[model samples]
Target chain A: MMAARRGRSAGLIRLALYGIGLVPAVVSFVLGATNRLGADPVNTFERTLGLWALRFLILSLCITPLRDLTGVNLVRYRRAVGLLAFWYALFHLSAYVALDQGFDLHTLLADVTTRPFIILGMVAFTILSALAATSNGWAIRRLGRRWKALHRWVYAAAICAAIHFILSFKVIRVETLLYGLVVAALLAFRVYRAAPRRAKAPPV
Target chain B: AVDLAAQPGPLSGEGLKPTPLRDVTHYNNFYEFGLEKTDPAERSGDFHPRPWTVRVEGMVAKPRTYDIDALLGRKLEERIYRMRCVEAWSMVIPWIGFALRDLLAEVEPLGSAKYVAFESVVRPSEMPGQGGVLPVLDWPYVEGLRLDEAMHPLTILAVGLYGQTLPNQNGAPVRLVVPWKYGFKGIKSIVRIRLTDRQPRTSWNVRAPDEYGFYANVNPAVDHPRWSQASERPIGAGGGFFGASRQLTLPFNGYGEQVAGLYAGMDLRRDF
Candidate 1:
């Protein structure tokens, strides 16, 4: 009975966290729709959504370090964070397509093809969407060990996102550089933590 | 300070100055307010220019403070001048104002005065962008030019535009309008003018000295670190329509005839 109650409580806690995670994305969408954003509103909306999407992705990536340090048992929350990041990323891309480009698929395709930065951003979003699609428990059970391999693409997505930001600005502002550095440090921590465990294991 | 009052009347006539109409009316580089090319108009409108006084001091024979109204009392001349931004955009504005030479003469520069530095008014209440978390500049924007550049006949201290009083966003009441060189060289809503022997540090040059030099001459060949400076889009062009765009930007914004002698024998690439 106690175990069942704990499971129910965990489920409730996750639902709350999921709702909280959607706030930024919801607010950004409402602001974009209401035209509350200042002049060049479309660009403003696109940039704001894109930045928040990247921030959530970064936060999702930091969960492992956070859980390891705090021993908070936060692993159960990883799927929620990853899914929210993907949702925000979808909104970010949609803003770019529907608002900025007015759903001009030809222009959009041309932009992705012509601009290396846009291509990088598109590739990152595509990888994120694929990961988000396979995040459910059913897919996890079906894929078994292959699920972890597929999820590793999140690292590639983060790298691509950082590159997308650097190449997007005509003049490189220090803010973008700092974001790149933080993402690099997070990835480095993951690699460092994994290397020792692999080295200690008997030849596999 | 040299006495600007004794100088001859500000230059007049279309031939004596560039034709204001044929001149491009679109290029500008004032970024304190925002980043878009048209951002200055939207962001700068909120700037209130009342009860403003410019402090004129340093190496001049006399230091004086003049209110905006008194400064505008001087004869206003409309000279259509071509303005080229360092970011590769150009405009022709029919600027209304007296020459900077006239204003400098009022301050009375002494023999030691070799350069003139100007400062913009920086108040958070008036400039909303000043409240930004990041340091866009060291507040009270600054621009400087060699004494010769300051004295150039083409250098006008603008007071109005479009035959009307200057709009607040366009640096109303008083602003420096240097036809040659990049638009940033023309500091806006000036509140201070100091004549000094040493070269004064300019805002952009101080912020990123490697990118923006003290001279800041409009050289098509000298590219800004991030973008090419070889060409510019004229203002009012249809969202960068091809045929309507201006040809290659001229050196010193094509005011070489009036101001080129000032930099004679100097390496423009190094000085720029």
Candidate 2:
């Protein structure tokens, strides 16, 4: 009975987290479509989406740390949350292509080539794409042991995303520092949690 | 409320689309209020621009402070200038003001003066962003122009924009308007003008000397460390979103004909 109740609550939590995760991106799109995004609405829309994508990527990284450190497990919804990050990142790129750059291939190429931040963002997106493509149960079962190893690269994606944020701004603000610190702490926690396990195992 | 047709302009912005007041007032980079575009407009509503005073000092025969109203009493003309930001966006604004020389003439700058430094008014209460978590640059922003650039007829201390008294977001009662340089060179909410032989240390140049120079002439050939400057999105051109249209950025923001004589053989690529 307790297991059933736990399952029910987990389902609700999954639905709730997914619903919450979608709010900013949807609001940005709604604002853009309605022409209510103020002056430079295109930039507003694109930046808002990009920020949320970075935020979601950060939150997705936090989940494992939260479970390990605090015993508050949201593991059931982690996949969906991870997927939301990908969705936001996808929209962010789409906004840049369709709205900000206006399908100008030359400008887009210039941006990707000249800006190191853009290059880092592209790398992060590629990593997220790979993880997203193999997220389903079918891919999970088919790939077997390799799937977990592949998905673990999300950590690398988070680092790239954080670096992208740092490099993107002309002036790196305190918010960027704070975000960087959070990513660092999350990675540190992973290393801490792995240390004892590594101590017990044979040396690789 | 006045008609656009009656406004005296094209001394700078000829054949360029004027950025609407909505975009002008809303889309800003006034770090005093905030780095974000909307921060100044929303936050500056209560900012008291009236009862302001400007002090002209340093190497001048006579230094004095004049009330804002007294300065505005001079013959003011409307100049539609194309303002380009270092961030690679551009705007054509109808600025109303008299030549900076008129103001400088009143003070009688001494022969020792080779550069004129401009400083913005810094108040934590008035400028909401200063106390914020991450202010972009130092307070009471300072910018300098070479004496020749300062004495240029086109260099005006703008008092109004779009034929209306300047909004608080647009620098309120007083601001410097240098047409050829990037927008940051036009330090806003000005309170102090200093004439000196030594080159003045500007806020952005002090912050990142490698990135922002004292003479921030708009040069398309030179790219900012992070971005391209070859093309720009004029604010009103409907090019910002999904990039529909982008015009090539002009040398010295198309004021090269008027101001290139000032740079005269200086490599803007290195100087930039």
Candidate 3:
């Protein structure tokens, strides 16, 4: 009974966090669609959504640390946060395709190929899409240990996304540099934690 | 003196005021101060405008210096033009200024002079963005034009906009306004002018030669490395559907007739 109650509470908490995460993305989209943003509204909207997507992805990555540090055991929220991140990322990609490119597949393909930053972003989104698709319980049960291995691709996706952002700006700003540093730290933390545990266990 | 209120045709229309221009100009990407679009406006407000002087030298029969006050005393004209940014945004502005040709004639360029190079005022203390971590272009922004382009009637030595003295954020005292090229071609807060036989390196081109070429012409066919120049969104048009629906950017910002001849012989893709 106690275990079941704890599971229910965790599920509710996960739902609430996912709802909270959507606020900025939805507001930015509605505001962008309504023409409430400043000059160069489409770019502004696209950038806002893209940044939120990255932020949520980073936050979802940080959940393990937060759980370990606070002893709150918030792992249940990871999937929800990850999914929300993917949703925002989908919108961000769609905005560029629909508004900027006017659904011109040729131009979009040409841009993705010519621009290194755009290519990086596309690669990250592709990996993220794969992860999001196989996130269901049936897939997880079927794949078993492979599920964990596949999800590790998130780390690569995060790095690619960060590089995508860094190269986008003409001159790299402090805000962007700071975000890059945080992403680097999170990645470094995961590697540090994983390596030591594996060494101590004498090769799994 | 340039009477902005008396400009001909569409510019004289009631909505064609300098406020929007001022807003856009004041808020800009003067990379010497910093690369961010808004950095120049924020950091440049405290710039001291008094005691300014423009030194005209190099390849000139008579090298001379003119004080800001005396420079403003020359014949001024109001030109309403569409200022297009290479970043794919644009604004229509009524500029109050005298012809740059008139200013060049004052110095009297030598027969061999082929290009006109302009420099902006550089003061790091007042411009905080100058202390940024990134290695942007050197201080004192520099812009240049071919001799023919420099002498073009559309190129103006702008001292004011909207019938008012230039606000600090808008490159106060004096700046250059070339209607046909991208906004960066018009160097701001200019303090130096030099006539050279060789083509001069512009600020943007110096920083990223691959991205920003010396010509810097506004050609819709030639796109920026990361984005397309095919369209632009007007300022204060609000975001989302409202802006997406109304903003229809025109090639050469609808000034092709006035300035297209300058690039007739050259392939814009190579030059741009």
Candidate 4:
């Protein structure tokens, strides 16, 4: 009975995670539809989705650290958080293509290839798409150990996302700086955790 | 707010629709107040623009400071201009002011004077953005124009917009308006107007020389380093649905007929 109750609570927590994760996208849509977004509604909407994508990506990265540091295991919900990040990123790119670029494939292609920041963001998104595609139980079971290796690219995606965020603005805003710092901290923690393991590995 | 009285000028926006007054006043890039579009409207409450004085000096025959009220006494005209920002946004504003040449004429720029530099007011106490630990751009925002550009009839010192006193966020009391150039060239809250022999350094150019050049003319051909300048989103148009709000950015902001002669033999690609 205790095990069943624990499983039920975990399921509820996962459901809650998804519920909260989707709020920003819904709110942004409603705001855009209602003309409540500020003067530059399209830019505001696009930025809102991009910001949430980066936040979710960071949150997904924090799962392992939080479990190891505090003994609060949230491993079951990590996939949900990662999928949320992918969905937000997809929406962000769609908004840019539809609203900002006016479905101008020529300009979109030019932006993705030429603009350094846009290129970085697209690179991150590409990696996210691959990871997201293989995030199901069947793929995980089939790929086995390779799944862990492929999913590890999330760090690279997070770093690219952080740099892309920083480069989007002309000036270094405090909020951007804070987000960059968090990503940097998370990356540093990953390196710190990996150092001892690498040192302990037997020679091939 | 007291309304500003002015006669209609020769230049008119007859067919063009002026951006909604709400968007015009609410969205701004006055770094003195803050960086965000809404920051100026929200944070400019403490700013005081009255009882201001603009000091005219440097390479001019008659160097004298003019009081803001005295300057307002001059003949003001309502001129509708389409202002394009370097960030690919545009707005049509109905401004009330006299030609900048009229003010320059009063000071009598010397034969050696080839450029006109404008400096904005800076008060950290009233402007919170100026008091930040690390500033985004140099304080006392500065801008410059070639003597010919400054003397152009299209250039005016705007004191009001939409037939009313300019709001604090919109560069209250006084501001520069160069219709053919990017909006950043329109420096605000004039504290000093100096005539110089060589080209004066502009704030944005000083910050990012490669991206924002000295001659920030609105040319669609020359793209900003990061984004295309081919089109601009018209503020307060079509509710930004399906990218329907975008319009092709015209060369020299569609004022080329009147201002293109100023750049006669110069290569805009290099000057830009």
DockQ of 4: 0.49
Residue A198 in candidate 4, Cα distance off native in Å: 10
Q: DockQ numbers for every candidate?
A: 0.05, 0.36, 0.49, 0.49
* Pairs that clash in candidate 3: A32-B240, A35-B239, A35-B240, A36-B239
**Runs in model 2 with CA error above 4 Å?**
A1-20, A197-204, B1-12, B236-244
Alpha carbon lDDT of each predicted model: 0.74, 0.84, 0.78, 0.90
| Residue-by-residue lDDT tens digits, candidate 1, B115-228 | 998998877776765666556678778999899889888898887776666666667668898888888888888889999999998988987786789999998877775545
Which 10 consecutive residues of model 2 chain A have the lowest summed lDDT?
A194-203
Could you tell which candidate, 1 or 3, scores higher by TM-score? Answer: 3
Chain B TM-score of candidate number 2 = 0.94
TM-score of 3: 0.89
Ranking by lDDT: 4, 2, 3, 1
Q: After superposition, how far is residue A188 of candidate 3 from its true place, in Å?
A: 2.8
Residue-level lDDT tens digits of model 4 in B1-272: 56888999988656878888999999879888888999999999998988899999999999999998887788889999999999888999999999999999999999999999999998999888897765789988999999999999999999999998789999987999998999999999999999999899899999989999999999999988788898888887645454346789999999999989999999999999
TM-score, candidate 2, is: 0.89
B86-201 per-residue lDDT for model 2 (tens digits): 98888889888888998899899988899999899988987888788766788879999999999998899988887777889989889999989999899999999999999999
Candidate 3 residue lDDT tens string, A38-119: 5566777788888988898898889987777678766777899888878888988998888766776766877888877888
Model 4 spans with C-alpha error above 4 angstroms: A197-204, B238-244
Q: In model 4, what lDDT does residue A196 have?
A: 56
lDDT of 1 at B112: 93
Docking class for candidate 2: acceptable
The superposed Cα distance between candidate 4 and the true structure at residue B1, in angstroms, equals: 2.8
